[model samples]
Target: MKQQVRELFPTPLWVLDIPPSDAAPFNAKLRDEIEKIISPRPNVPSGSNWQTPHDLHTRPAFADFTKLVEISARSVAQFLNVERYPMMITGCWANINPPSAYHPTHNHPNNYLSGVYYVAVPEAGPDLIFQDPRPSLIMPWTGKLSPLTANASAEQAVPGRMIIFPSWLRHHVPSNEGTSERISISFNLMFRNFAETAASPRWKATAGQE
Candidate 1:
């Protein structure tokens, strides 16, 4: 008799790395804009700090950043083979985590996709961790296992790297041990129907036809 192993129920996560030359300028601009716009506060329940308004993508100072996000999002849609319909960013914000700061586990509500782009990551910075979505799998497990059976997985934070994952996935950032702050920009994206637009003729032609 012959047996084979099959994998099922795979989750998708996308990571994009921006070159240092491009990322450096953007990082400097972002830091300056963040400093001018708002001061850090205890917005999140955990130890981290969150920027207010959640519409940073719409600001003039973030035009280039927004373009980067749009391009990245389109790439993700293409990878998922959903490029027919349009997609738009619903919200965007920044997180500044200082030494010993951490973010509690949470999921983005009412959003289809969520992502984070690291602007600055110090040495020994905290890692982004995702928890297993299946609760039953961990109920009766006691032995050690590989990623397929693990309860959680961690990804190191790297400057200029962007990570995208399902909005429903629960994730958290561990406490930062580095001396400097770990800065990142996070955003949510959702699919938009072409029929909703009245200004585009192309949309009118395809609207209600899909």
Candidate 2:
């Protein structure tokens, strides 16, 4: 899976081509609904800010979305030998970049997993950059290659594709250099049902998270 560079990072990262058969009409309807919510918030950055859609959890389209993440998580969790599988929908935020707008490099705080479903990816802008998290953990003695600073290795933004990875992974999108808009939705997730499973216990805070 590693190509063009040494394995510079750990943690699972996946670019899934979600079937997206019903996505055209679904995307159309989704845009309409999102517009309604957004018309009121004219100052909001659709590409950067996450505005939760109405009935996102109960809506059929969103249910389908949830199913996709769930199936993916179950497969990965079991493969990784995780304890519980109560993935929650932290929130779903849509992004529509008009010209030069782009999201900054950031990781979801206080979450377990994060995902993005791309609805539209116009040419010439916004590449999701995955950087080496441990730039300082390098061998002091130089051998074959000069160590590079935490650098972006690749950029991905294709329609009907879903990218899921651990929430803590630091990722960013380069500023949109293209003329058209970019559309996508980001989400956060965490396990919910642990006590029932009895395999592992969830972390509990005593008066404080620290």
Candidate 3:
């Protein structure tokens, strides 16, 4: 007899590393551009020291960065073998987490994919922690086990690194203990519908007539 094993329902997490040479300058330029036009908004649901309004993707200054993010998102969709429709960025925003600032566990809603790109991360910046989405699987837990039964995982943030995951996954960031701010740009992507595009012209005409 031969031994057999199988693994099911694996989650996908993609990480893209941008060379330090390119990342260092790009991050500095982006930080300056963000400060010039966007004002910090209070009471952000994601829990940041400061968060920009969720319209960064529409700004002219972010045009190049937006293109890069879209490329990365497309790669993720391709890896998942999703070829039915084109994926596009629905929104983008920035978060500046100062010391002791943290984000509570939450997931992006109404989007197929979500991601974050590190613009600036201090040496001791907090890690990005993810929780297992399936809660029922743990009902039979008898005792703390090893990697085979682990329910949560953490990834350290690196400057210029990009991470993409399913929007439904629950994840959060721990408190930033470093002196400097941990800056990151987050975005969401969704599939585009042909019907929506076809109706745009008619909608425009109707609005003009009204």
lDDT of each: 0.84, 0.68, 0.83
The lDDT leader among the candidates is 1
lDDT of 1 by residue, 39-71 (tens): 644455545555557999899998988898899
State candidate 3's TM-score. 0.82
Residue 3 error, candidate 2, Å? 21
> Candidate 1: global Cα-lDDT?
0.84
lDDT (10s digit) by residue, model 2, range 1-210: 866866554566877775568667666666676676567655755444344562355566567666776777677667667745566666767776666676777898877778887767778746687766664565454454332633345647777777888888898877667767677777777777645664465777788557
Worst 10 residues of 2 by lDDT: 142-151
Question: What lDDT is reached at residue 7 by model 2?
Answer: 56
Per-residue lDDT of 16-105 in model 3, one digit per residue for the tens? 998999999989889998777555534544335777878888988999899898888777777887755688789899988977789889
Can you rank all candidates by lDDT, best first?
A: 1, 3, 2
